[model samples]
Target: MIRKTLALLLLGLFAAPLWAADCSTTIEGNDAMQFNQKTIQVPKACKQFTVTLTHTGKLPKASMGHNWVLGTAADEPGIIADGMKAGADQNYVKPGDTRVITHSKLVGSGESDTVTVPVAKLKAGENYAYFCTFPGHAALMKGTLTLAP
Candidate 1:
């Protein structure tokens, strides 16, 4: 009985990490004004999902700031436009924007931030997009996100 219990405990320990890994992800943005990934998959089983944005460059925020913004694909253009009007002090995201689902704070080279999004806010068949709201960066720094089965 003692040996059996020890084996079961080791098995549980090994499986713990896989369970935890399902609800979180990391995305990297660089000085080139680009995000390394173009797509993200959110599992339906997750109650909440976290996105960690890492700026791996050496430039200052004024010249090369990056942020992670999430919204429906149809809302992206308007959000980006309005965010530009909102300006840098607001992290380029319009204050009290209802269209935004989740977003990370503006970050510059060597900086990082994370945003948590509730899975319930997502629809399985709808198209969602994520982008950096820093001025002209959204043109190249955008990607698709989807809820997965």
Candidate 2:
């Protein structure tokens, strides 16, 4: 019984890291108006999560700017519409938009920005989406984020 318990403890120790959650990720946006990742799974163990957006292409913000925007999939249209009105100075996100859960600043080629999302705000079964608000870029620069069970 002592030997069995010791072996089980060793196994548990080795497996602990696997069960631990990763609380951050990096995503890339390019000149072609594309995002490198299509889906992000936020681990439930995280109290908060950080997403880093890197603009990987060679273009200026005026023409190929990219920013990370997060909201419910149902709220996407309204957010985008308001963001456009908010204009570039606001990083293409409306000021104080309640629909926006979190967002990163607009970035150009070789630039990057990060956004922190409170895990408490995410619902496991709800559809959450992330996208770029650069004019007309949403058609391609978009992805889904979900809270892990």
Candidate 3:
């Protein structure tokens, strides 16, 4: 029994780091209007999560700006439509849009921005969408984020 207990404790010590909470991630957007990651998992243990958006291409905000926008999958279409109308001055996100869970500021080549997502706002089994609200970029610069079980 003593040997078994010690072995179990040793295994746990080695394995703990594997499950260590990851509460943040970095995503890259390029001149081609693309995001490097297609999926993000928010560990349940995290009360909040941070996402950093980095623009890796050489381009100006007027032409190739990228911003990270988050909303429920169902809210994505309306959000994008309104963001288009809101224009570049608004970071491609509509003002006072409650549907948006969180968003990063518009970023140009070599620039970066970060946004914090409240984990409490996430619901299990609900589909969350993240995308760049730049005009005509949603089709390519989009991904899903989910709360881990």
lDDT agreement with native, every candidate: 0.95, 0.95, 0.96
lDDT of 1 by residue, 66-123 (tens): 9999999999999999999999999999999999999999998889999999999999
Best-to-worst ranking by TM-score: 1, 2, 3
lDDT of model 3 at position 7: 100
lDDT of 1: 0.95
Error of 3 at 146 (Å): 0.7
Error of 1 at 47 (Å): 1.2
Please give, for residues 25-137, the per-residue lDDT of candidate 2 as tens digits.
99999988999999999999999999999999999899999999999999999999999999999999999999999999999989999889999999989999999987899
lDDT of candidate 3 over 1-149, digit per residue (tens): 99999999999999998988989999999998899999999998999999999999999888999999999999999999999999999998999999999999999989999899999999999999999999999999999999999
Report lDDT (Cα) of residue 122, candidate 2.
96
Better of 1 and 3 by lDDT: 3
Q: Candidate 2's C-alpha lDDT? A: 0.95
Query: Model 3: residues >4 Å from true position, as ranges?
Result: 1-17
Clashing pairs in 3: none
TM-score of each: 0.93, 0.90, 0.89
TM-score pick, better of 2 and 3: 2
The deviation in Å at residue 123 for candidate 2 is: 0.9
The TM-score of predicted model 3 comes to: 0.89
Q: Rank order by lDDT, top first?
A: 3, 2, 1
